[model samples]
Target: MQLPGDPRIDAIAEALLADPGDDRDLEAWAGELRISERTITRAFRSSTGLSFAHWRQALRIHRGLAMLAEGLEVHAVSDQLGYGHPSTFIAAFRRVMGTTPGAYADQP
Candidate 1:
């Protein structure tokens, strides 16, 4: 479903996906794209069906999954994802993915 004349959102999505862990200011993103923060937020919501924060969390989880698949320990994965602590990473991963990193790592 295309929003009428709203392709800026696509750019926002690309930028987000390209750097999932970046905590850059939304205004910076808007400025970089030459669009308003409202426009960026609106386009992001329209494209992802979730707020930018949630989408970023999901992307972090996806990255965590990849790290697990590559045999990295949870601590390493958490650090790689810029998580403040392993416990924080574990909690976030479990909350979003419904499984702890250990369980996910052990899965066939």
Candidate 2:
């Protein structure tokens, strides 16, 4: 995956990788990086060929899979991944992986 070359985006990626459960949004990152949210949006899309929201969704789903494999409960994984609702997380996981977190986790 080709991440944006912008330092701000890089910082966000590092932060997300370090803590995938972070609830930080573009505004938070913009303030932290001392840039405008619009800049982050444009820069992110320009370099990654994906919107910030789209990228973050993929990141969260990817991390969620690992957490599930680690034996984390669905609700706990949803919360740890900054999901506001377990149902939302479950839906996203199902959409992306074609299986619910519980089913995936049950797979040996």
Candidate 3:
């Protein structure tokens, strides 16, 4: 998806794209940007067509695909993306990609 035009939203998007494993919540970002958390939440949904938390999960899972393709083990990718447990990462991956990380990596 293209970056949203709002400079503040764009800044958040760029940061996440650069570091998808950031794991920072919208409240933290809003605090850093000196905006109300509600403003950030509304702007994020309006600009991206996705709530901030959902977008961040999608972004992390998308990045996980690349890592898996590059031969990273599921546990390794999960750890690198800041998942506290491989099972959590696997569940999120399955939701986004319709397959477990190991299954995805085995695709020809």
TM-score of every candidate:
0.76, 0.85, 0.90
| lDDT values, one for every candidate | 0.76, 0.85, 0.85
Q: Mind giving the per-residue lDDT tens digits that candidate 3 earns over 58-88?
A: 8889889888888888899998887899999
By summed lDDT, the worst window of 10 consecutive residues in model 2 runs over 1-10
Candidate number that wins on TM-score, 1 or 3: 3
Q: Give the per-residue lDDT digits (tens) of candidate 2, residues 24-81.
A: 8898898999999998898878878878888788889988887778888999989988
RMSD of 2: 2.0
Q: How big is the positional error of residue 77 in model 2, measured in Å on the Cα after superposition?
A: 0.7
The reply for model 3, stretches above 4 Å from the true place, is none
lDDT of 1 by residue, 1-108 (tens): 222235776665565566555666678878888988887777767777767667677878988898889889999888877688999999999999898999978888
Report the backbone clash tally of model 1: 0
Which 10 residues in a row give candidate 3 its minimum summed lDDT? 1-10
Measured with C-alpha atoms, the lDDT of residue 78 in candidate 2 is 92
Worst 10 residues of 1 by lDDT: 1-10
Stretches off by above 4 angstroms in model 2 are 1-3
